[model samples]
Target chain A: MAHALEPQAKTLAETGPGASFGVIQGLDPRMRIVVASVFSIVTVSLSTIPGLIAALAVSIGVLLMSRLPIRRTLKRMAMMDSFIIFMLVLLPFTTPGDAMFNLFGFPASWQGLWKATEIALTANAVILSLMVLVGTMEPVTLGHALHKLRCPEALVHLLMFTIRYIEVLREEYMRLRAAMKVRGFRPGTNWHTYRSFGYLVGMMLVRAIERSERILAAMKCRGFSGRLLLLQEFNLTLRDYVFAATLCIVCIGLLCLDFA
Target chain B: MHIVDGALSNPVVIGGAIAAAGGIAMGLKSLDLDRIPTAGVLSASFFVASLIHVPIGPSSVHLILNGLAGLLLGWAAFPALFVGLLLQAVFFGFGGLTVLGINTVNIALPAVLTWIIFGRLIAKGTPVQGAVWGGIGGAFSIAATTAFVAVSLALSGDEFLPAAKLVLFAHVPVMAVEAVLTGFAILLARQVKPELFYKGASA
Candidate 1:
């Protein structure tokens, strides 16, 4: 399905290319990576309502610690909610359980309501924590952290190159759109509009491929040997260890609360 | 389009993860060091595709364009698209962490399949001829992707069946728009850089 990364088109402008702040900024990038993954898995396995709420609370705590703008991060989480809202709204009607209410002769169920609430809580918790702990980190640091974490080298390289080029290509795209606007190209529900947009995409791809060729040549001239070197240095300090332990403890607490 | 975390049965989630891992392995195998820049740049290019919303009456829909990605990148579309999804989830909170595997499989599997089925035909013959095949391939990929997504939802539980069907039907218009756009895109590429389609490693 066609979905925008940000419904409001402000995620890029707001993050401004990743400004690390407060405690999350000071922690080792690798630590943040591990904590985010562990927390997500732990949150996913949680089922009880109270436990899920606490997970959301823990995520909020992380957001505060990261010093990311709270309203912006939660708004992004709400943006994701818009996509799943349809399925969630329909769940109560389709699911069989104790009756809650009726809409258009369709009886909604309490069990289905609980299920939707469960999903909503779990998704928000994971995404919120993820955005705070990992999303706010400079993308280049994330790549290097993955590299240090022993992810596949080529995959890491791809991630780095993609991060490096998104801004460049997006600028290229903006320029194209601006030129179209200057030419009185107003996109609408017409054959001509789709055709123009398609050509625009095609032009971007063609230019992208050609540009990469030039980059490869330039890199080769400087002894580029298929591998882009990552010169990031990482060392885990006591604070990173303490921060990771606290997160792990919180995760264990969540699992215990869910099961017990 | 994203399946946020905790929405699927454990088995479906695990199975999707395994499938995605296998696909990514194949994609990486096909992607040598020499092709990294090409693959990376093209992947970033497609990322911009989602930001371009085409107006459809009162509502505008962004472009997924995975079919065109399959045509250009072949098997390499797997990791390339995965990278895009990853960026979206981490940067924009667009999807979930645990569901990344399933989401990747849903989106990229169809892309690779389209490449397998239509990659060569879209490269050969006249520009117009290639574009016709490109259009077909574009529509086909969207169809296959929605089917996969619906199947994943249905498999997760009985409660999701209606939602599954709805997801499938809602994407019909997407298939048409994507088909036309992809056709025109291929037409442009065929006219400008005919050699772009020759890099189909899986072909």
Candidate 2:
């Protein structure tokens, strides 16, 4: 599990300092999150190619301005784009419309191609916007921003704890995995393997429960209450307002293009 | 089985958000203070569970384990699975932020349903019986989730119908694997720590 989480942990660590150096990183995390979410919603709502193209342009502009590692961002986008490409291939074959071409003796529809492109553009635009906006911010900052945004308190706390303990649990899992490997146990597609894996998961859960008990005890010893006290203060600067306004105007313009 | 952002129409997205909010509220209301740590730890466990990939026929599939979660956490599965989905979106980009609500609904609703339908059986049964019922709950939850995901996509447009079908067909193997895994998990839990199921039931 630690091995599996290495890439994610690395990405998170890489983004932490890079976020502070980004062009839009100066804005309040709340503002950045709100603007990015709004932009993504509008991007998803787009139906016309022109509208999507404009949304993509806005996203790219933010990406360039943020100075995120371009190669890493593109690699993530490509991973997401593979799903869209799958949709592209399937939609053309399954959708009903006037024939645009023949693929393996099946009539591919223009409407299918159109819808596929629409989905592709919408997904890409949203992914790019997130890479620039949410990806740059620290998870704790994002959690605080969500709390400020009126997200449910329980959900917010859950997110924080999940992030905090994920590494710990991954380490525990790696130990278990190592133990299994040392015993020459390799995962295979068989009932014996499934049962062994189940025991592994069960053991992990048992440990997790016991660990949580210890955590709760520690928290209570410290007079910990249900409410988390966030120390980070956020003040919206003039540049934040300007950036948000610009993003809103661009989003609205793209929406108007969708109707046009 | 996570749905990416921009995959659904506005109406579907709005509806999913509303429904998810209701589930999360119920989950939070039922969650007591002592249960909080358990929920958090279980949530983290669920998050890490996704990293466990098991070999299938020609391909490997990762664990979703919403069934086992529901069996152990009941209504809390909503928030637990939601946190997992949130982190997955944040770190791996497996899903999107905007569609988090819908994705939450698509996955967690089945979890809650399984809890409602099978939670009691697991609580009352012997080890072997618990495994049997747990297996049913596991496979049933996956099937229900695939159905929910398919309906969400199909509701978006006629053009998405094929994708919807594909999502369902793709999960068939996952359903079987989850059943076996959940069965063994339940068996082990019943033998090792029966208290977890009892606590889940009382919650």
Q: lDDT values of the candidates? A: 0.88, 0.83
Worst 10 residues of 1 chain A by lDDT: A1-10
Q: Which stretches of candidate 1 lie over 4 Å from their true place?
A: A1-20, B201-203
TM-score, cand. 2: 0.95
Residue-by-residue lDDT tens digits, candidate 2, A196-232: 8888888988889889999999989988778868879
Residue-wise C-alpha lDDT for candidate 2, range B12-45, written one tens digit per residue: 8889889888989989888777788889988999
Q: After superposition, how far is residue A176 of candidate 2 from its true place, in Å?
A: 0.9
Clashing pairs in 1: none
The window of 10 residues in a row where model 2 chain A has the poorest summed lDDT is: A1-10
TM-score to true structure, per model: 0.96, 0.95
**Clashing pairs in model 2?**
none
